[model samples]
Target: MAGHAGLTTHVLDTARGRPAAGVRVELFAVEGGERRRVAGAVTNADGRTDAPLIERGSLTPGTFELTFHVAPYFEGFEAAPAVPFLDLVTLRFTVSDASGHYHVPLVMTPWSYSTYRGS
Candidate 1:
């Protein structure tokens, strides 16, 4: 992972079959039982980060958390007749190895969401 090692993420609006644009994402690192914000950005038109969440040279083996704000994204959707059940979605995972690619893809709707390791 020396060349281009980093963390990346994407969100697919399963309900709409499209990228989740304008979603707010926050990256945090766990330290001594406390969470610290490392970096953050909003998803682009394609629902992918414009830059890697964590760059290669800055990567470390540890636990990380990604919080995605999904409330506003579903507020006006016709399918969301009521307030969304999930407002702030958080995904916590570990980076045991920093030399490999880590792609976290989230499939989500106004009421629920799921994620997994992606290629």
Candidate 2:
């Protein structure tokens, strides 16, 4: 895995105890003191990104943010109420080590969310 450089992310819907499919994920890097979008992907049925957040041979050590657009997802589902608590959720962290696996997992709900580094 070290030889194949890349970054990955996953989102689990704690409210439903399942993968948060069709959730939009945006990857941004803090470059020159500015946040820039480097990549974007949508969560699949397994709550995992359809592709690596950052592709191989493109990984770099820097501060990064993965913004998950969840509000629209909840609003689209009639089962969920029209008014959701969270509009946009962003997880900011550093990719200090580029050679290793970085798994960012998010467990979220309409009212709250949680995330952590996973293997």
Task: TM-score each candidate.
Answer: 0.94, 0.88
Instruction: Please list the residue runs of candidate 2 whose C-alpha ends up more than 4 Å from where it truly belongs after superposition.
Output: 1-5, 76-81
- Superpose all Cα atoms of candidate 1 onto the true structure and report the RMSD in Å to 1 decimal: 1.2
Q: Summarize candidate 1's per-residue lDDT along 73-116 as a digit string, tens digits.
A: 88989888576788999999999888887888788988789999
Per-candidate alpha-carbon RMSD to the true structure: 1.2, 1.8
Global CA lDDT computed for model 1? 0.90
Question: CA lDDT of 105 in candidate 1?
Answer: 78
* Model 2 pairs in collision: none
Model 2 TM-score, 2 decimals: 0.88
**lDDT score for residue 10 of model 1:** 92
